[model samples]
Target chain A: MLEIKNLKASINNKEILKGVDISIQPGELHAIMGPNGSGKSTLANVLSGKDGYEVSGELKYQGKDLINIPIDERAQKGIFLAFQYPTEIPGVNTNNFLKTSLNKIKKARGEKEMDTLSFIKMIKEKSNELGMNENMLSRQLNVGFSGGEKKKNEILQMKILNPNLAILDETDSGLDIDALKTVAKGVNSTRDKNKSFLVITHYQRLLNYIKPDFVHVLADGKIIKSGSMELAEQLEKTGYKGIN
Target chain B: MLDFKPNEKEIEKIGKFSIEEKNFRIENLKNFNSVGFPNKLVEDWKFSDLRHIVSKNFAKLDLKLKPSKEENFDFIKDFEHNYIVLVNGRLTSNSFQHEDNSQIVINPYLNKDFSNKKEKNPLINLNYALSIEGFNLEVKDNYKFNKVLVIYNLFTKDLNENILNSQNRIKIGKNSELHVFDYVINKSEKNFFNNVYEDLYLAESSVFKNISIQKNRSNGFFHKFSKNILSSKSNYSSFIFPLGLKFDKLDLEFNLEGENIECNLQAASFLNKGDHQEIKTRVNHLAPNCKSYQKVKNVIDLDSKGVYQGKIFVKNIAQKTDAYQLSKAILLDESSEFDSKPELEIYADDVKCSHGSTSGSVEKDSIYYLMTRGLSKNESVKLLINGFLSEIIVSIKSKTMKNFIEQKLLSQIYEH
Candidate 1:
């Protein structure tokens, strides 16, 4: 579902990701665990086609070159990135934005757009399953929302859009235990053979909820080790310095 | 440059006035002719070079203009209310079936008080000199209107290189209440100028709310100077949506004359396609325990220019006065321009007065976040602009009125 080889990304003439490589098949969940500023978020940003990055690497998604695609086109082509710090957009109702976004993606993919009635029904169901207050969807997008509510809103978006490849960039960082479990449950419910997830995290707590098929240790902009859940447990015990 | 200077014959054409009124007209006309149109040298006209803009746009401006045809205009079907229709700044017709006729007095404006005050704005001088038509509205004491009054100011298509000046006054008696929607609809295809002078007086314990908006884009150069006086315990609120004109300027002044008055002024505008707009306001806290607030927001597209100059003054006797002012702008492109100046003058040490102004391009992070949700760059920027302006629109308490104004605002944004 996704492939990368010798991926390097830089901004302002400073290199952040250097020769990092990762690969995942359809239905596989991959985890990239790294300490602070280890290019984990950079990888997610570069994959989602954020501008201002001087990127030179072999990055392919679904056997197509993804480097030249614009950010919205990549999103339309089934790529979703859950931001670490969700933006608080004032005066924009969450439900209205979601509807516009869903319809745009739907039109780009040659699918019928959902009307307001059905869209409301679908959103109500998805938010209810995640135990989010229905009123949150009517308020301004993430404006005055709590940290946990913002993260859960991101997961709720992931469920609504139902993208092919979802990149979770530190989605579990600020969540409490209950929120973390609900986020995990939301992710677990959407797992299927046709969808893929690249869970990027700094701690092993999130790993205990939704187990990853493979885990890679990212240190100093490079993946130094690749293993399973055991690798995350080892890192929690010894830290990044213990690996070397 | 075309001569905007008017001769005495034009004043005579208006009517036979008393000696005092005639002298007032002659003095103001002389003042207007001396300055012609205000230039960038004037402190209040620095951001707006009216002299240069007028020279570039008009070859000749006719001072005497008569409506040639009975123009048709659509009354707003969005809400039920009483309405007054004005064509080319001349009051044409009105209906007040929703109110007690005895409590309401509406008539063609005849300037009664000929008190001569030296005016600094040349446009105001011009209005006083050549003004002929408008409406004088007075509500009887303790009478509250059952429905909102809609003033439909329409400019006909026959207007070309013409200038129209009018004076309007609205007085709410003690303990009376009124709400008004000043709707302007222009059909003029060629360039014309419209100058308006409005006076509002809120009596003791009276309440007045006014919402002013433009219907669509037009080839109109507009200027309006509104002066409001508030009495004890009276409340006055104004919302202005000035959009889609070749050139527009609103000079507003409010005087809190009595104790415990509350005054609020808010505006949201979308300027595009080389449109120019300026809003200058001065609010005076003359009484104790009064509160005043001013907020103006603008979105300027390519080649458009927007300006806001707001000032708050608190007198020495006006202790415990609270005043706040803020101006925010979003420039969409390099060619777009926004200029803001906020001023506060306080002689009362116990007063609370604060002012702020900000102007910048839209946030790149906000665009990126929206794009990640499958919205294109254009769509994302549009959504952000709408969101920025909707903060003001949502303040309208009536949902139907809010939606109507929101649709008009959206059309202005999308027209670009």
Candidate 2:
């Protein structure tokens, strides 16, 4: 589903992601485990088409150029990135934002947009499954939300969007046991043969909930090793430095 | 050294009007003679350069004129409200009337009497000099208005440059509730000058919501000054929306006369195509336990300029006064400009007062976040701006008026 070859990226004339290569097939759940400053987050950001980055290399997704398209175009092309720190928009309603986003994608896919009633019903159903309260949908986007609530809100969006490829950037950090389970359950419900996921995390705790098909250890801006789900357990016992 | 002189054309224009009671009119006109329509030299007129804009043209008193043709505003058709139409500063037809049993009275204000009031502004003095007709509204105690009262101040096609002046006074009795809307729609090509003054008095425990909308299509110059007085336990909420114009200025003053009063003043201005707008505001915390909040937002495009100057004063006796003021602007391009000056003068040490002002372009981070949600750059900026200004609109106490102004606001943005 995705291919990256010698993905070199830099910010402010300082290189962050050195020559790196990775490949993910359809229906495969991949996990990238790394320590601090190991370019895990940088890779997610570069793939999502964020601004202020000098990137060069061949990055393709679904047989199309990923880096050349705009951020919104990439989103319309079924790419979703769940941020580690979601922004708080003080005046934009959560439901309205989600609706606008869904309509954008639906329009691009030549699918009919959901009416207000159907949209509300669908959002309510998904939000209930994600354990999000009714009042949270009317509130401002991430404004004054608790740490766990913000992550759960991200999960709610992911469940509603149901994109072709989802990138979870530290989605499990700062979540309690209950919230962690809720996020994991939400992700597990959406797993299918046509969808792919690239989960980035610093700990092996999140892999325990939703098992990965391939686990890659990222060290110093490059993937050092790739193995099965046992590689995650290996890293939990022996840290990233211990493996090198 | 304040040197004031009146121009010859202004004097000639004043002579054209036949005055029965020349004493008050001449005195007030003489007061305007000394000030000569406030210029940049005046402290209050520093941001609004009214003298330079209207000095070359004279406000004519042409009585030999035909009634203006009817104007059809598209948004007005979608809503149902009582309408009082005025064209070229003349009352055309009013389908709405004050309730006789409800103690609400509406009449033409023809009072030439001058009072020893507190506000001493040159424009008010000019309005006082030319004010022969306007609406005087009064509501008695415990009366609640069931319908929204809309005053459609329309400026239809005009062939001459006229000076249209209006004076309005609203007095709400104790425990009364009223909602009023005043909208100005200009469709003429002539560059006429409009001067309007509003005096609002809310008795103890009364609630009043006032809204003003101004959309000047042609190159017109408009100015409005609203002075309000609030008593104990009374609440006064005022909202103003100015979409686009050639030249516009609005000044609002709130006097907290009694304890436990609340004043909310909000406004939003969207200007482009070299339009200029100035908003000057003042809130005086005279009594203790008073609360005041002021939120002003502006979005400037092209070479348009916007200016906001607000001040909050807490006296020594006014302890425990809570006053907050915020003014923010979003400049779309390099040519557009915004100037904000917020001031705080407090004599009480135990009062809670804060003021802040910010002017910047749209944040790239916010745009990127919205973009990642599948909204394009243009859509992202528009949505963020709508969110920014909608906060003030949602604060309105009247649902119908809020929805009305909100629809006008959205349509204005989308039409571009």
Candidate 3:
């Protein structure tokens, strides 16, 4: 569902992703583990078409050119990226924003819009599943949400939109044991045979909940190694130095 | 009216005219000379230079033009209560309609004995001397008016006209409620100057909401001064929206005279090229346990300039007072300038007073975020600007006013 061919990206004249290549098919989950300066987040940003980057090389999603699509269009095409630091939009309610985003995606897909009552009901149900209270939906989007709450909120958005490809960037960094499980459960529930995920993290804690079908070690802005789920356990036991 | 000659004869003649018209003119001139215009020399007005607009000769407008009722007056024609019409600072008796229960007091300056009190400022003295007509409204105690009170100030151009001045006074009785909608509409293309002074007195337990809409011509200059006095347990709120004018200045002052009084002032303005707008407000807490809140927002495009100066003062005896003031402005272009100064003067140590002022361009990250969501850059900027000003726009109690403001903001963004 997603492909990156020799993806070269730089921010502020500093090359972050140097000729990185990766691929994932439908119904499969891939984990990219790397050290601090290994350009994991940069890869996610380039895939999502975020601004402020000089990128080169071809990126294709579902047999279409993905490098030129706007971020919102990418989102409409079922490409979702859970940001490491979600923005706080004051005075904008979470439910309203979610409805707007969901309707945009639906409209792009030539689907009918949900009525107000049904929309509220859907939000209530999804929020309940994610252990989010009703008041959180009415509050301003992420104005004062805790670290774990923001991550869960991102996952809730993903579930609502039902994106084709979900990119989780450092979603488990700030989560406690309970929050980690809740977020993992939310992500796991949204998994389908047509949906794929690119889980980017430095640790294997999140992998325990949503097990990856493939594991890859990213170093020096390139995928130096790739293997099955056992590679994750081996890295967890010996760290990145053992493979490098 | 004095001639343009800088001779003692002209000054003496105008001085005599001022004394006969307003008894407090001489005392006001003394104070005006003492304080002058607070410029770089004065710390309080350091950020704002009033010297350019002040310290100059303003012609005394003559009440000669007759009232012309031509346009559709649907906004205020159906009111059952009494109303007054001011045309070029001249009050017209034939144009006004009065009801049985409503009494229209015209030209209060002719009946009430005028005095020169030490507390009276120079601007008040100038207005008192030059005001053509004053409307005194006294709502009966415990009286409830089913209709709204509407006052219209219509300006027209005449041959060789320079300026116009008007003043109005309103008083609401105890347990009475009043809604005053003041409209300033300009119909001429002349370079006109309008100076309006409004004084509102709210009795104990009285409630009053005043909404002022300025829809003047593009070439006209408007200066409005409003002073409100709130009695014990009275509630006073005002919303000022200035949309069409080349230069506009609004000076609003709220005096909390009695305990437990509440006052709220919200203002918004949108300016385009060569348009200058200024909103200056002062809230004085004289009694204990008073509350005041002020919010002002402005959007400037191209070479336009917007200014906001808000001051909150808590007296020594005004303990336990809660006061909050905020002023923010967004400049769309690099040439546009926004100046904001929020000041808090507290003599009471136990009072809770806070003031904040901010000026900047729209957040670039926010724009990128919205653009990524499929909205164009312009759409994203408009949405963020709307959110920035929504804090004050949503507080407007009138739905019509709220929608009008929303439309105006959208149009401004489109034009930019």
Candidate 4:
């Protein structure tokens, strides 16, 4: 469902990712483990089509060129990125924002838009599944939200949007054990043959709940090793420096 | 260019007046004629530069009142309340169906008080000299209205290159409560200038709330100077949404003359191309234990200029005075400009006073975040702008009023 080869991305002439390659098939969940400054977030941003990045080499999604697509178009094509730190947007209601985003994607796909009643009902159901307070959706988007609440909000958005390729960039960071489990459950429920997942993290804790099909160790802008769940277990015992 | 300076003979043509009133008008006229219109040289008019703006836009400034074209009034269907209709700055009709008629008094304003000191503002001087139309409203003591008072300030289609000056006075008695909505609707097809002077007084323990807004876009050059006085324990709050005019300025002054008085002022506006607007306020804490707050926000687009000058002053005897002022602006284009001046002067050592001003283009990260959610760049910017300005609107306590204002403000942002 997604492919990248020799993807060298730099910002302001400072290279962050140098010749990285990764490929995932439909229904597969891949976990990328790395230490600080290992370009884990950079890879996620480049895949989401964020601006101000000088990227070269091959990057394809669904066998189509993904490099030239704008950020919104990428999202319209079923690509979603759960931010590590969701923006605190004051005066924009969380429910209203979610509805707008969903309707935009729907309109782009030539589908009928959802009305307010159905949108509210769906949001309540999804938020309830994530164990979120219904009151949070009525407040300003991420403004004054707890760290865990913000993370769950991102997951809830992912579930509502229901994208094909979901990239979770450190969605486990700043989350407690309970929130981590809830986020994992949210991801696990949406797993199907046609959907793919890219879980980026520094630790293997999130992988304990949402088992990954493959594990890759990214260090110094390159992936040095690739294996299965055993690889993540080994990295937990020995630090990233202990890798070959 | 045609002469804007009015001759002394024009004063006599307005109406018959006492010798003292005639002299007062002539003195103010002289004050205005000395400086045809305030330019950049004047301290308060520095950012506005009215002389240059007038010279560029108007060839002649007619001081004669024109007959109204008799257009049907469009009352707001969103809510029901009392209304006072002013056609071309002249009080045409009024209704008080929602209140006790005996507790309220309304009349046409005839400025007979000639005991005030000479004014410094040329525009005020011009208004005092030429203004012959407006309203005078008084609420009885210990009475609260059952509904909001809607003041419909309407301009007719017959006004072209004309100037209209009017004065309004509102007095809230002791222990009384009043709420007002100053709604302006203009249908003039040609350019005209409007100058207004408003005098308001809040007696002891009175509560007064006001909201001012424009109904639509118009070819009007508008200016209003409001002077407000608050007595002991009186509370006053004002919300202004002044938009869709070629040039508009609101010069407001509030004086807290008694202890434990509360004063609040907030304004939000969206200025599009060729629109120039200014909100200048001076809040004076003359008595002990008074608190005042002011916040102004603006979203300015291309070729539009927005200015805010707010000042707070505390007297030496006014201990425990709390004053705060903040101004925020987002310029949508490089050519759009915003100027803010916040000043605080405190003579009381125990008082807490602070002021802040910030102006910048919209944050790129915010736009990118919204765009990532499947919104186009234009939609994202509009959403951010609406969100930024709506912070003030969210503070309104009435849900019905808040929803109505939200719809109006949303359309203003989307249309731009």
Candidate 5:
């Protein structure tokens, strides 16, 4: 469903991603594992069409050239990025934000928007499954959410949007064991033959719950090796230097 | 002390009219002629230079007060209120269908002279001097008013430059409750000046809530003043939303005369495309155990400008008084500006008083996050602005009124 070739991106003319290549088929799960400063987060941001990036390479999503599209258009086309650091917007109700987001995407897709009652019911069901408090939907989004609550909320957004491909950029960091399991469950529930997930992380802990179909080791902004889920087991034993 | 002159020709002919029969009117005219207008030399009128807008030769054009039009009163028709309509500064109708054993006394005119009543402010003096008709709106003692009373001040387009002057005194008697909505509509096609004065007195154990909306189109200028006095065990709440006017200088004052009185003063103005609005407020705690709270917010874009000056005073007898004041603004453009001054004057050693003011542009992080949720840039910015002002708008007690104001705010945002 997605493909990247020789992707080189930089910020402020300082190179971050030298050359990277990855390919994912529909219904497949791919995880990028690396050490800190390996450009894992940079790749996720570049793929999501964030600003202030000098990017060059061939990136295709559903056979469309994705490099020139705007950030919101990319999101409307079902490319969701679970932010590592979510924004705290005071005076903005969480329920209203979610409803507006869903309607925006639905309008872009030429689909009928859900009414208020149905939208509330669906969000309650999804939030309940993610172990999120119903009251959180009334408070300002992420204004006072705990660390785990913020991550869980990101996953909650993922479930509510039902995107075709969701890039979880370090979705497992700073999460306790219980939160990690809940997040993994939320990610696993949305897996389907037409849906894909690119999980980027520094450690293999998240792979333990949501096993990936393929594991790629990214070193110095380039994917040096690709293997099966057992590859994560090997990386846990040996460090990045020992991977080669 | 400035060399400003009275520009309105009709104002100079006030002696020819019979309304000068009252001594107060003549004193007020003298005050207006001598004092002229407010300028930068005055401390309270520092930011708003009335002389700049009301030029020397701008006469109050002569126009006839015609009958009411349907469109002039459309915006406030849906609200649940006792309707009081004024056409060209003249009262046309006062009706109340819902009365729960309440006494509402309306005196069409005030006999006393109030020219020397307010000596410090010249614009207020001008209002009283030119005002031909006045209203004494009061609720008798121990009588609770169930319906919200709405006074609609509307204008009709005329060839002559219009100057509207009207005074109203509202009194909520002991142990009574009342809610008021003062809505001003400028349906005139050309620019005019509207100067209004309102005096409110809340008796002991009475509750009063007021919401004022000034929805004037482009090139309209208004100078408004409202004075309030709160008695023992009384509660007073006021919310002012000034959005659509080209230029506005509004002054509000509250005096806590007795113990156990509570007052809330709030003002919000959203300006765009060179629109200007200024709100000045003062709250005095004269008795012990009284409380006052004030918050003013402004949002401006393009070349608009907004100003807020708020002060809190505590007398020596007002020991154990609690007062808080805050002013905040959001400037959305480099050319847009906001000026705020929050002051506190306390003579009581045991009183608690604090004031704060802040201004800033929209947070980039906020915009990016909203855009990531599939909202366009314009949509994202609109949502942020609305959310920023929702804190003050949500405080309105009536759901319909809140919705009405919200719609007005949104339309103003998008229409530009």
Candidate 6:
């Protein structure tokens, strides 16, 4: 469902992703493990179509040219990225922002938009499942949210959007044990036969809840090794220094 | 020194008015000289330099012929109520259709021998002596008028180029409610001047909401002043929305004379090109336990300029006064500029007063974020600008006025 070939990317005239390659099929869960400065976040940013980066590569999603598509177009094509640091927009309620974004995505996909009542109902249900209180939806988006609350809020958005390819970029970094389990449960409920995920993290603790199908060792912006779930267990025991 | 003198030919042309108006003009000129436009030495006019804008001769507009219904002064075509229409500076006969229990009074200046009070400002004296007509509208006590009172000030052309001097007085009796809409629409293309004065008196327990819409032509210059006083337990709300004009200045003063009175003043202006607009407001809490709120917003593009000066004063006797003032502006281009000054003077120790002023351009990071979401640069900028201005529009209590402002903002967006 996703393919990257010899992808070279740079930020501020400095190369970050040097000839990186990855491929994932439908229903597959891929984990990319790397140390600090291994270009993990840069990879996610490039896939999301953020500007200010010089990228030269061939990226295809379901046989479409993904590199040239805009960020919102990528989102409309069922691509979602859970940011490690969510933005805070003051004076804009979370529910209103989500409704506007969701309607735009639905309109782009030629789907019917929900009315006010249905929209409110959907938000109430999803927010309840994520353990978010009713008042959180009425407040400004992430204006004064705690660390754990922001992560859960991102999970809530992912569940509402129901994207085809979800990229969880260190979503478990700042979450507590309880929040981690809750977030993992939310992700597990949305997993389907046709959906895929690319989980990027430095620690393997999150792997205990959402197990990976395949684990790839990424170092110096290149994948050096690939194996089954056991590879994650081994990395957890011993750091990336010996494996590389 | 700036050249503040008016052209000799222009003064000679305006000398053809009726003998009464000519005499009034001479008296106003003498008064104007004594109180010439306050210079930078004055505190209130510190930021605004009036000498550059006010003419030397400053002739008063002549009273034109009586206006008619065909001139489109009727706000609601099918709906009927007491309506007064003023063209130039003359009140047309049969212009107002008075209903039962409502009194229509015009030109109180001639009826009552009232002297001009001592106001350090010269403009007050000039406006008093050269007042064309004063509208005295009274709604009977305990009477509920579901219809709105529309005062249409239409500017039409005349052979002589002179300044328009108009005054309006409105009184709401005790326990009465009324919705007053004052529209300043200019269709003239000549170099015209306007001086408008409005005085509102709200009785005890009465409710009054005034909305003023100014859409002047490119060649028009306007100077409008309004004073409102509220009685005990009364509610007064005022909104000023100015759309198009070359140069416009508005000065408003509100006095809370009774305890537990509620007052709100909101003004918004959108300008483009070489247009200039200024708004100055002062709210005074003279009674105990009074509440006042003020919000002023402006959006300027091209080479336009805007000025906002707001002041809140709480007297020593007025304890428990709660007042808040905010002034915000957004400049869309490098050539555009905005000047904002917000001041709070409190003599009471128990009063709560706060004022904030902010001037900024559109957030580039927010624009980039929107653009990354598949919107073009123009669309992103327009969306952000709309969101910024809609903060004031959403606060409007009238749905019709809100929709009107939305349409105006959209048109401005498209034009830019």
For each candidate in turn, the TM-score is 0.99, 0.92, 0.81, 0.99, 0.91, 0.77
- What is the Å distance of residue A172 in model 5 from its true position? 2.7
What TM-score would you give candidate 3 relative to the actual structure? 0.81
State in Å the error of residue A208, model 4.
0.3
Worst 10 residues of 3 chain A by lDDT: A84-93
Candidates' chain B TM-scores in the order shown: 0.98, 0.88, 0.82, 0.98, 0.91, 0.85
Model 3, B272-305: lDDT tens digits are 7668788888899999999999888887787888
Model 6, B1-416: lDDT tens per residue? 43333222333343355555555555555566565666657666665556655443234444232432435443644344455666664555333444444433344322133433445555665565455664566665775566666667677644244555667677888888877777666667666666677788889988998777764435677777878989999999877877777777788899999999999888777778777788888898999999999988888889888988888999999999999999888898899988888888889999889999988887766654454343456766676676666667778877776776677666766676
Query: What is the lDDT for B234 in model 1?
Result: 98
The model with the greater lDDT, 1 or 2, is: 1
List, residue by residue over B68-164, the lDDT tens digit for candidate 1. 5647878899999999888888888899989999999999996767777768898998999989879999999999999999999988888989889
- In candidate 2, how many Å is residue B71 off? 5.2
Candidate 5, which segments miss by more than 4 Å at Cα? A36-38, A217-226, A234-244, B1-23, B56-72, B75-79, B100-102, B114-118, B215-218
Model 2 alpha-carbon miss at residue B349, Å: 3.6
RMSD of 1: 1.0
Assess candidate 4 and give its TM-score to the true structure.
0.99
**3 or 5: which has the higher DockQ?**
5
Q: Candidate 3, which segments miss by more than 4 Å at Cα?
A: A64-69, A76-78, A102-131, A176-182, B1-19, B22-64, B73-113, B116-130, B143-162, B179-191, B213-220, B396-416
Give all candidates' CA lDDT scores.
0.93, 0.81, 0.74, 0.91, 0.83, 0.75
What TM-score quantifies how close candidate 5 is to the native fold? 0.91
The better candidate by lDDT, 1 or 6, is: 1
RMSD of each: 1.0, 3.3, 5.2, 1.0, 3.2, 5.5
Most accurate candidate by DockQ: 1
Candidate 2: regions farther than 4 A off: B1-21, B33-35, B55-83, B95-98, B115-120, B215-218
Arrange candidates by lDDT, highest first: which order? Answer: 1, 4, 5, 2, 6, 3
Question: Per-prediction count of colliding residue pairs?
Answer: 0, 0, 1, 0, 1, 0
Best candidate, lDDT-wise?
1
All candidates: DockQ = 0.91, 0.72, 0.34, 0.80, 0.71, 0.25
